[model samples]
Target: MAAGGERAKPAVQSRMENFRKVRTSEEESPLPFSDLPPDVVEMKVKEGSKIRNLMNYAMAQMELKGRRQIVFSGCGRAVTKTITCVEIMKRKLGGLHQVTKVRYKTLLEVWENQDPLPGGPAQNLTVHKNVPSICILLSRDPLDPNETGYQPPEPAAGLQAQPGEAAEDVSGSSSKGLKRPLPPPSEELLTKKLQVQGAGDPRGTGASDHQPDHHQ
Candidate 1:
C-alpha cells in the first residue's frame, strides 16, 4: 500500500503544477481593448450572443436615441456573425456610411499530459495562435436628407394624406376651370320671355297672333 501511494503522489502534484502554469499563461494572453471613437456606440459580440438581442440594442441606440454612429466588433468565430448583424442593420436603416477594419488577436493555448508512462515526467506545451478579428463602423447624418430614405416599420412614416391638404386640393380643383350650373329662377322673378323660351311655350311661337292679309 505504501509503495502504491508514493507512486500516485507525484502525478497528482505534477497536474496541480500544470494547472497553475496554464492559469497564469491564459491570464496574460488576452490583449487590451482597442481604442474606439467616443461619439459612436460600440457593441461587442460573442459566440453565445443572439442576433435578436444585439439588434434590439442597436435599434434603441441608432433609431430611438438618434445616435449618429455605431460600431460592431468581434473576434474568432464571432467575426462572421458580427458582419451579418451590421448588414441587416444597414439594410433596415439605410443612408449610412460604412467602414471596416481587420485585425488579429493572439491566444495562448495550453496542452498538458496528465498521465505519463512510468519513469517519464509530465509535460506541458504552450502554443500561441493569432485569431482573426473585425470591426465595422457605420455612420450617418443626424438629420434625414432624403425623403425616399428607408424607414423602419415599427414607427409610422405618416404616408396617409392629411385632412388640411386634402381640403385644399379639393377647393383648388373646384375653383379652376369648373363651371357651376345657375340656380333655377324663382316664379316671381321669372320673365315672360325667359319662361316662354324655357320649354317651347305656346306664347313663344308668335304665329298664333298673326292676322290674315286682306284681298287687294
Candidate 2:
C-alpha cells in the first residue's frame, strides 16, 4: 500500500506543473514615450519655438528700449559669442517683465545682419557682425565722441581734462601752477631712531644711569 501511494504522488506533482500559468506580453509596462499624447508632443515643439522667439525680441528691445550696454563674449567661436549675447539679453529682459512679443534670431541670421549700432545715416541702429567679442556703447555715429556722453575717467588729481594739460582748479583756471613738493626726511635722524628702537632696552635708556639705587 505504501509503494502505491508514493507512485501516485509523482503523477499528481507532474499534473500541477503542467497546469501552471505563464504571463503574456500584454502584462508588461507601457513605454514612456509611447504613452505620451500626440498633442502634448506637438505642443512641446511649439513651446521651444516660442522661447527662441522671446529671446530674440528681448535682445532687440534691450538695445532699443532699455538702452543698456550690450556686451558679447564667448569661448571657441564667434557664433557662440553671438548666441550668448542674445540669450543674456533675453534673461535680462525677462527679469524686468514677463517675456512677451519676443523675436528669435539664429547665429547665422544675426551675423548676416548689419551692426546693431550703425554710423552716419543709421544712427541709433545696431549692426551685428562676426568679429571678436566686444562691448558696444550705443551711439549715433562712431566718430561722434559726445554722442554717447560716456564720462571719461578722472585723472589722479580728481579732475577730467584733455590729455597733456592739467585740469582747472577751483578758480576755473588751469591747474598749471607748480605745487610745492614734500621735503625729504633727514637720514641721520631716522637711523638714530631706528637704532634706539632696536636696542630693546626695557626702560628704554641708552646706557644712561637714570635709575635710583635698588638697595634703597
Per-residue C-alpha lDDT of model 1 across residues 84-196, encoded as one tens digit per residue? 99989987887676666677866677777666568988677777778887777777743232323223232223433466678899999788637445435674366556656
- Give the number of the best model, judged by TM-score: 1
lDDT of 2 by residue, 11-92 (tens): 8776444432221111112222222223221111111244455446545645556533332222223334445544454345
Poorest lDDT segment (10 consecutive residues) of candidate 2: 39-48
Local distance difference test, each candidate: 0.68, 0.35
Q: In candidate 1, how many Å is residue 50 off?
A: 0.4
Flag regions of model 2 displaced more than 4 Å: 1-69, 78-216
TM-score of model 2 relative to the true fold?
0.15
